[model samples]
Target: MQESRLRWYGHIRRRPPDYDSNLALHLSLPSHRSRGRPKTRWKDVVLNDMSEC
Candidate 1:
């Protein structure tokens, strides 16, 4: 009985947990070290030039 239990333990140890868990720092590192904020284009900012008569 002890031998059988030891075999099961060895088998489980060989296989890791099914749930996937990655380091948060590894995933967010790219965004954290990215360039400055994107600039707004002239076309994106609309101006109101019409005056009421």
Candidate 2:
């Protein structure tokens, strides 16, 4: 599941910025203080996968 998801992410990354999927990929949500920990981002996931490779 994760591998397929990552592969799809790669496809999305290759798309032009005007594409909805690409826009969504680059979109940032409003920031607010959190209690314990910060969330893992898509970039982090991709970096982790690359490091493993």
Candidate 3:
């Protein structure tokens, strides 16, 4: 699982800065949500694994 996440991370990183997938990864949207803990996002998973490396 970690290996696959890293592989996909690398693939996304290699994309052009303006690429949809890459851009979306860094997109931020202002919105309201219920009062509760937020779910872990795909980017968050990949980034957390990266920090463990």
| lDDT of each residue in 28-50, candidate 2, tens digit only | 88888698887888777877876
The Cα local distance difference test for each model comes to 0.37, 0.81, 0.90
Q: Judging by TM-score, tell me the better candidate of 2 and 3.
A: 3
Global local distance difference test of model 2: 0.81
RMSD of 3: 1.1
**Considering only N, C-alpha and C atoms within 3 Å, which residue pairs clash in candidate 1?**
none
Could you give the C-alpha RMSD of every candidate to the true structure, in order shown?
Answer: 25.1, 1.7, 1.1
Clashing pairs in 3: none
Q: Is candidate 1 or candidate 2 better by lDDT?
A: 2
Query: What lDDT is reached at residue 8 by model 2?
Result: 83
Task: Provide the lowest-lDDT 10-residue window in model 2.
Answer: 1-10
lDDT of 1 by residue, 1-53 (tens): 44554454445546655523222212332354447975553222221111111
What TM-score does model 2 achieve against the real structure?
A: 0.71
Ranking by TM-score: 3, 2, 1
**Of the candidates numbered 1 and 3, which has the greater TM-score value?**
3
Clashing pairs in 2: none
